[model samples]
Target: MVGDDFAKLFRTFEHTAFRLEVRDRYDASYENESLRKFLAGEPDDLPWIQDWLTMISAATQRGLRFSRVRVVSLPLTDYSRFGVWCSQFTNGAGEDIRYLPRPEATAAGLPNHDYWLFDSCILVRMHFDDGDGFLGAEIIEEPAVIVEHNYWRDAAWHHARRREDFATEQRIERY
Candidate 1:
């Protein structure tokens, strides 16, 4: 549902003014074929995905200064190359960085325990359920909402364990 909005949003925000605070998986489901394929080492990199990375890399070049990167939940494994991607945008010194998970859901709940934060931006959740019973969201933007979800992610992060083994690999750049 949000795919179209994201498509348009991506185009608008792909430039310097726009920053991201991704909470859940950056690329999840077959719907995000461009990102998934690129992550899977497919030959073609999606233009939007590439643009997204380019923005992040550009932000990094500017000393990793973004509005914010609040990670709430990470469906993707911590050991995955995704961490390497995060590092490229978050950690520049190349030192292993361990996140400080919130002990509980913050007063402002969004989603994800990992909690990627950014300021002065909008969010759109793409609900991909193949059922007429549900109205899948194509774009969602509201303040004082998504509190329950954000709480859930915070709870999970508190209970979640860090992937020490994967963190080691990240330090070595094996991924």
Candidate 2:
């Protein structure tokens, strides 16, 4: 699913595997806000990301799997709470998708690509800038790229801080 526009891009997939790797707080915020607003009784203002979340929810309702991975510069301020809710829409029987810190993600050798990289045969991405705009990318049928991204994910996974469970630190939601 590749398109310069979000509507066209998302419209191409009704049921397909998605391995998403987002790199920044804004990216995470955009996605999280879009999904959370919809789930929390707000109207679907950002229908694009919300639809995917809805799809994941529907799949879970039908006992299917929806996979995802989030790579961010820092931990989301309220990941634990968000995780509990997001679990209702994932491949691991509603388990929270893995969240990897940027350094960890870098260590994992996760392929770092611009927004366009998501259009490859193995990944999907929504591209945005600090200006609060949006676009989409998809990568399918690209094994080498996927392998690279996989390694990156591993390194990221190991380096990401699961600080949510630790009592010594306080997280300030900077976004």
TM values, all candidates: 0.37, 0.49
Q: Which candidate comes out best when scored by TM-score?
A: 2
Estimate every model's Cα lDDT from 0 to 1: 0.39, 0.47
Q: In candidate 2, where is summed lDDT lowest over 10 consecutive residues? A: 166-175
Per-residue CA lDDT of model 2 for 1-175, tens digit only, reads 4344544543344444434455443444555765576346554444344556665566556654444556655444454434433433342334235556556556555666533222233454455666544444544456876666555544544554442332123322211
How much does candidate 2 score in TM-score?
0.49
lDDT of 1 by residue, 108-166 (tens): 34343222222223444434233312233433356644444344434444543343443
RMSD of 1: 8.0
RMSD of each: 8.0, 7.0
Candidate 2 Cα misplacement greater than 4 A, ranges: 1-16, 27-53, 75-95, 113-121, 130-132, 150-175
How far off is residue 169 in model 1, in Å? 11
